[model samples]
Target: MMLLALALLQAAATPSDAATEARYERCIDLATTNPVAARSEAGKWQLANGGWFAHQCLGMAYATEGGWSAAAVEFEAAARAAEVAKDKRAAQYWAQAGNAWLAGGANDKASAALNSALSAGTLTGLQLGEAHLDRARVLYATGDLDGARRDLDAALAVVPEDPLAWLLSATLARRAGDLPRARKDIAEAESRTKEAPEVQLEKGNIAAASGDEAGARAAWGIAAVGKGAAAESATRALAQFYAK
Candidate 1:
């Protein structure tokens, strides 16, 4: 799961004026550096009519503290407040809420928030693509493969440079028995970064699916030495392959 606190921070839009922007920036900085203090300050600010930006900072503070559900609530509140003011930031807040819900393992709520974000039609560029990518993840988790595929395609169209999008597209294609597309998309991902363990693991999986055991072993060898879940998975795959 891509629990992206930094991405949420980057998505923060400029406030209406200079003072509001400065305050938001300070709160966000505090949220990252000292979440407890940020949360307290943001709460007081919210009660003092700090508006949507206050809720946004509060959400960031909660996220930094690993309070995904609370962060989601704050983001949702920010979205509603932005909507009431007809602000473009509403879509961004909805997207943040969806991501927080996803991080919290609330797929149903994530889907709802993502739906609102997409329906707003206000998101553009990479933000729009990321929103689609996130929705695709939610759909895939819910067993809606077709929906996931559609959203992935849309994401790829908008963010062709995003290796994660290509990696996911490749994985989905491999799962759906579309080896040709899997190969193409994985190549796109690999071209972007051959060092990524997940990319290497997926490359190994695709190679194994194609009956290329040697190729699989080579890729898995690279992945096994890397870190995190992908490395662990690659190690297991090598064991299973050798046993077979």
Candidate 2:
């Protein structure tokens, strides 16, 4: 989601004219409001030599339509084009490609793209932190827990205010059997957002692991109030707890 948000914010590469800038802006707006139209507009622009900006918009359009693999291809193409032009935005495009790949469940491709982005060392601040976080997610999915932990630590160091980073770090800690770390990280996540079901679920897990059945039950109850995967998982956890 963050990556998608970033894509929406992308500006054209110092457009040669105001008209080009306006066109790019319009295409990006269409990407969010009407992805099908955006795709057609971007395709036309690309045929007219819109370069990396056109590819980037096309990627955003695909992403908005939930076409993750197509989005990744377009983003990677944009990154390559930017690189050929010696543009600093190439790193950002690579990061976007990695996010799309991750969304498509292609962890290997995600890892490679993210590695390219980070290795460039052009990203900074929140962008840098998010790139690390995305790579961590890929690593976690691929069962490279230690590598994921390292990347999560890097992300937390750069973006301590991000609740998702804290939540994921807490989840990883709990999975690694580091209850104390889990509790600490989850508390940080809770401070940022007390009502998130995922945070509450992690809290329940950490509490359960610490042998506090009542605390776990209460947290899971809070988690179960919502609908979706987290709530379903909380319900299952509650069922198991009751059985015990």
Candidate 3:
């Protein structure tokens, strides 16, 4: 009968819902480390549910990998769905939209989305920290050094244990011609995260600035294992140094 068919449809939809949710979580995880794989699986779910999480993940895949155009589409879709969800995840979508805008070089869009994310009031502590960090980076890129400094300060105030704020502070200090402060901050950040090769690279920068050739070489060697693009260039630097 019609009623039996309706009940069966609802039953089938339940498992599909669970599977979609699982796929979203998987996509978020894989997107960071292996975006191609993440997108391949996530695209399948997007064909069905394509809800906030799916759009957000797709957006993240583009933003993080520097594919700005594609990121904008997914992030905008995410923002729309997130507002409709009216749930905790809504703020996250707002942040993603802002980040994608920043990646896309659409400064105004980034600012608006970031403001909305703050206003939404659902961001987790870590999410808020990351948002501040990103906003600060964008501000710096746009030559708003004063604004960038303020945001970095705010992020550090919120999460003193996070090494990234310290790292950013060091870079900012160096750019501002405060080598002493840069050295001190970079040293602290490097000391905090011994396992992170990027920290080693930061330390290497400080060492080079201070003319500690041996120390810089050692740090750069460690940093060569990092995922940063500079890793390859750093290896070349090392090769040139040894060749000398």
Summarize candidate 3's per-residue lDDT along 32-92 as a digit string, tens digits.
6787876776687688776766777776666557686687667667767867866656666
Model 3 misplacement above 4 A: 1-54, 57-68, 84-88, 101-112, 195-197, 208-228, 232-244
Flag clash pairs in model 1. Answer: none
Give the lowest summed-lDDT range of ten residues in model 2: 1-10
TM-scores of all candidate predictions against the true structure: 0.94, 0.93, 0.65
lDDT of each: 0.89, 0.87, 0.69
Question: Which parts of model 2 have CA positions greater than 4 angstroms off?
Answer: 1-17
Following a full C-alpha superposition, what root-mean-square deviation does model 2 have from the true structure? 2.2
Instruction: Judge candidate 1 at residue 12 and give its lDDT.
Output: 77
- Candidate 1 C-alpha lDDT tens digits along 1-244: 2212234656478786888788888999998889999998899889889899999999998988889899999999999999999999999999999988888899999999999999999999888998999899899999999999999999999988888888889999999999999999999999987788899999999999989999899999999998889999999999986686
Best lDDT among the predictions, by candidate number: 1
TM-score, structure 2 vs. true: 0.93
TM-score of 1: 0.94
Writing each residue's lDDT as its tens digit, candidate 2 over 91-145 gives 9989989988988899999999999999999998877888899898889888999
